[model samples]
Target: RQHSAQTRWVVLNLTGEAKSWTLPEASGATAVLLTTESTPPTINGNALPLRPNEGVILAI
Candidate 1:
């Protein structure tokens, strides 16, 4: 999947608070957190958070 245009940086804002949320990720797709926050978020039962001014590239 080289140079595939299926990667997207999704930003999530918790308003400086910790919260639980869900996103629409493609089946069997992958996601990478690009944030530098001390506490990483969770996704689909996993700890993958996106801090302020940060993003996660989701493979769809």
Candidate 2:
């Protein structure tokens, strides 16, 4: 993940299927789904679906 101080935004790269990470500092922080090769992604046990090749910014 890349965090930009200038934009105050984080860029997360999630690949493959059924992948998850423990982001303690990401609590209450927003997430933007940059890309998806197949199925959508989930954050914090919540379902955040996205279309193929879609760029959707979501609030996690």
Candidate 3:
């Protein structure tokens, strides 16, 4: 979702096991804005690791 000058990305892992999500190509760097889990998984390049039932909001 985009609003004003900020673009937000929402990622969720609904499966029972860990998963990796490939993020969309962005013009600028991305960062984790919010997460549902206590320990958020690391962002590997454009790929994000997400635990089961985890969700995150990213800023780009």
Q: What is the C-alpha lDDT of each candidate?
A: 0.52, 0.55, 0.46
Best by lDDT: 2
Per-model clash counts, in order, read: 2, 0, 0
Candidate 2, 53: how far from true, in Å?
1.8
lDDT of 2 by residue, 2-60 (tens): 86544234555567774454445745455544455546666566555765565556544
Which numbered prediction scores highest in TM-score against the true structure? 2
Clashing residue pairs in candidate 1, if any?
Answer: 41-48, 41-49
Give the RMSD in angstroms, all C-alphas superposed, for model 1: 5.7
Runs off by more than 4 Å, candidate 2? 1-7, 26-33
Tens digits of lDDT, candidate 1, 7-36: 455554533445445666553334543443
From the highest TM-score down, the ranking of the candidates is 2, 1, 3
**How far is 37's C-alpha from truth in model 2 (Å)?**
2.1
Error of 1 at 41 (Å): 0.6
Reference-based TM-score of each model = 0.37, 0.51, 0.30
Tens-digit lDDT track of model 3 for 1-60: 855655544544434233334445673445544343423444544444654346666655
Candidate 2 has a TM-score of 0.51
